[model samples]
Target chain A: MSIETDIKQKKFRSPYQRLALNLIYTSNWIQYQQVDGFREHDITSQQYNVLRILRGQYPSPIKVSDIAERMLDKNSNTSRLIDKLLAKKLVDRKSCPNDRRAVDVVITEAGLELLKKLDPVVDEWDNNMNAITHEEADLISSLLDKIRESKNNN
Target chain B: MSIETDIKQKKFRSPYQRLALNLIYTSNWIQYQQVDGFREHDITSQQYNVLRILRGQYPSPIKVSDIAERMLDKNSNTSRLIDKLLAKKLVDRKSCPNDRRAVDVVITEAGLELLKKLDPVVDEWDNNMNAITHEEADLISSLLDKIRESKNNN
Candidate 1:
């Protein structure tokens, strides 16, 4: 559905405004779809993101700051997210060997296992994009990249 | 910057995965831009969204459930958001006359003024999209609509 119909708004101030709202609305729509699957595993989308990052660097721990930098949500409280993941035994933290003041985080075996279980859910999410062709996916990705170009220059 | 450069990751499982990540990352980028402006007014983005929804129905009140339905984030605690906005004197809430079981919410004069102040910030956001042509904006919006079509059907 178009954003206007989905939100029940009749109009937008401009095409840029419509694009802005559509991007946000669509992002939220995607998150909502993932939340149910993440909730089933007692984790959040942010936590799932964290685990995936750690998995990408498996066997090599990453610093909290690095994790924050890689996170999709720039505002997420990395320390707090780490604390929750720790409680869940899905991740482990250790003092950085070279940097005394820094802590390194790594996904535990359980974390990897959990992500393995979530593979199908994540796959289902990716499959949903099949509604748009590969060319369309590439176009959307580049357009999104272009949208951020102005910000990147600043 | 490409999504890989932004996140410092070199690989994605597929183009669809890359597009999904880019969509989410770009959305967060837009939100972070808005957060600074909204923060100055002491309102979270979700609260700002709620206020905008109420403004659309100014001079008339809306039910909490209706506000929830219109919200970008489906998981937002609408009643609690209204409570905070009420405490800040940005909105007024009362029991519904037609349906005693439902509560109605409306933007206060203060709320309208707050949104007025936020207009420039929102405009600046829209201006940022000028990096992309009007045609590009239209294409992106339609592509996003296509992306959501699969979910909407279910």
Candidate 2:
């Protein structure tokens, strides 16, 4: 799965260039797999992420802003995802007890049950990350953090 | 910039889970920066990628599917992106000589010139990938390849 072999591109300006492209490509590759698994349960990754976050704070409602902050895709439309989940009856929405315009969101029992069924598939994909050793996984994550630490050129 | 601090989350089921999320998150972060730079030049990443691909095939007309196959994001609507670049007068599209319905696509002078201007910014981003050593870039790319080599559970 070298970038060349994976994408069928024969040349890159440099290893760094290939790595930059490969990082984006591989992430999309991994994403499609996760999307396929999540699709079986009728949810997008964003919705599943929100559901999981709510479940983590189970029995205690969390603010929509809090969920947005914790999401992997910071630009994801939290309200849209929430609306979808609510339509599916997988999540609950209610006016905050303390603030009229604020909302308290939580995973419904159905959402928890859905995730319980999805746990094995999700767990399997997580295990697939072992395609590289634990040490390599740690190394990749650290390197990615370093990549982001580079000053924003804007 | 550690995962915990970046995402403000204290727990991950394992390093692999963190790596999976980090891969996608960092890719998105890098993309935004690239998008910002490309925007300064009046192009999106997808358009830039198309231009680069067309430049690679300079002096030769390429089919739309060929461009699609070479794209980093396989799901990109290359025809649509081509439409945008075409509207900007950056790419030339014509009916393939041999096939009436098939179109031949090539980067116009304007497109190549645009890329020439973007080269410095793109190069800077590639250099930014050097936030890690060349050895680390290779390592991360190889590890990412391995990450995708895992069996598709479906």
Candidate 3:
């Protein structure tokens, strides 16, 4: 199950190239695995991410910009995502009392309920990582952290 | 920076959860790094991936479905992506001679030229991985492969 075989490519120009492709491909693979579970609950992973962020804040609402900053996929249109969640009545958007020009977004009761249902789905996903040991997971996480170290400085 | 600081979160439920988030976040981080370069050439990363797939099959045409199978991002609408590339004149689409019902796709001369210009951008990205050693890259690539091993079985 090497990347070469998975992608049907015979070789890479370098290890870094292979690693680069591996990271993107594996990330997509993980997301695809969750698609069915997320679709069952009628939410895309990004929307689920938004709901989770709001749930984390609970009673306190956060600005759309802050949600965008924390989103795993930075390119997602935060405002548009909020609009969709609002349409579904899973989230509430209101003018910020502290900053009238800004908007505050909070998860509604339905959103929290949806996440409560989704908790096991996510837990199953985490459990699947049991294929790799805890020490390995820690090592991989640290390596990923190191990979992003240089980018943070810039 | 650690995933915690990067996402502005203070905790993860477990190491596996941390690893999962790290994988997605780092992958997106890598992609965002390439956006500006791809944008300069008027293509999204998914489009870039399509062009590369076509380039790999150069001197021969491929079917849209085949392109989808080879794509890194499984959720990308391959046909729509080809339509965009077609509009931009970066690729050519024609009816298959053998299977009239199937459409064939090939990278145009313009597409090849665009990739040539993008070579440096991609090279710079590979170079940035100097933050991690070649050994670390290899290790990560293997770990990712291991992570997907279970998924491939299903």
Candidate 4:
């Protein structure tokens, strides 16, 4: 199905316009799909992202700034997001022992268990992309990397 | 220049994984840029999207469902978004003359004025694509189109 039919829009001004719309559209589409997967466990995609990040730092505490820096959406209010996860006991936060200005965050055992369950679901979620072959996926990946390359100089 | 440095990530399992991350990361980057542009005018990207949809239906009111159907992010709450636009006096909403169950929405003069003001900003936004040549833009666009084409059968 063309994007025209997908959104019921007639046409785009140019392919760049089309690409811009499509990147946002497809990314949002995949995000919603991921959200649905997380819904079974009553978590939003952002929460899941936080959980994964915390898991990466399991056994070692990480600072809020570090998590925010590593997040897919860098500007996300991770302080608030961590607060939410803390409310659910999926993550534990405390003032850093050596650096009081920073807060330490770590995933809990329950959180790890939850992610263990979610791992298979995430795999299946990526399976959604099986429609595109690995070759196409690689090509698209390289192109996107190139697209962001210019931002490096600035 | 690589996504590795851009996000400061250590590794990806495969190009497919990288593509997935890049799509989401780049899309959000573009959206945040637009958000800054829209914020200067006191409107959000979602609000701008709604006003554009209403303009597409000028002289004939459109329904909340119609707006949802045409939105880039279908999961967004159209009713709530429209309510915000209504509060701002950017749009008018009333019961459809033909169907009381349906609400009709149309952009007000103020809304069109806002859009007119936003037009050049949007064009400048598009011009940012000049970072990628027309040829690269087309390639990116085609690649994204193909990516979504796989979504059709599902």
Q: What is the TM-score of chain A in candidate 3?
A: 0.95
Which residue pairs overlap in candidate 4's backbone?
A: none
Stretches of candidate 4 exceeding 4 Å from the true structure: A149-154
Among these predictions, the greatest TM-score belongs to 2
What's the lDDT for residue A137 in model 3? 92
Indicate the TM-score of model 1. 0.91
- Which of 2 and 3 is ahead in DockQ? 2
Per-residue accuracy of model 3 over B81-147 as CA lDDT, tens digit each: 9989999999999999999989999999999999888887897888787788899889888888887
Which predicted model would earn the best DockQ? 2
Mind sharing the TM-score for model 3? 0.89
Q: Which of candidates 3 and 4 reaches a greater DockQ? A: 3
List the candidate numbers ranked by TM-score, top first.
Answer: 2, 1, 3, 4
- Residue B96 alpha-carbon offset, candidate 3, angstroms: 3.8
lDDT (tens digit, per residue) of candidate 4 on B37-88: 8997889999999998888788789989999999999888999999899999
lDDT of 1 by residue, A1-154 (tens): 8788788777777888888888888888888888877887899999999999999999999999999999998889999999999999999999998999999999999999999999888988987888888888888888788779876676
Candidate 1 local lDDT, B1-154, one digit each (tens):
8888888888887788888898889888888888877787899999999998999999899999999998888788998999999999999999999999999998999999999999888988888878788888998888888889876776
Ordering by lDDT: 1, 3, 2, 4
Q: List per-prediction Cα lDDT, in the order shown.
A: 0.89, 0.86, 0.87, 0.81
How far off is each candidate at the interface, as Cα RMSD in Å? 1.1, 1.3, 1.2, 2.2
What pairs collide in candidate 3? none
What is the C-alpha DockQ of each candidate?
Answer: 0.73, 0.76, 0.70, 0.55
Off by over 4 Å in 1: none
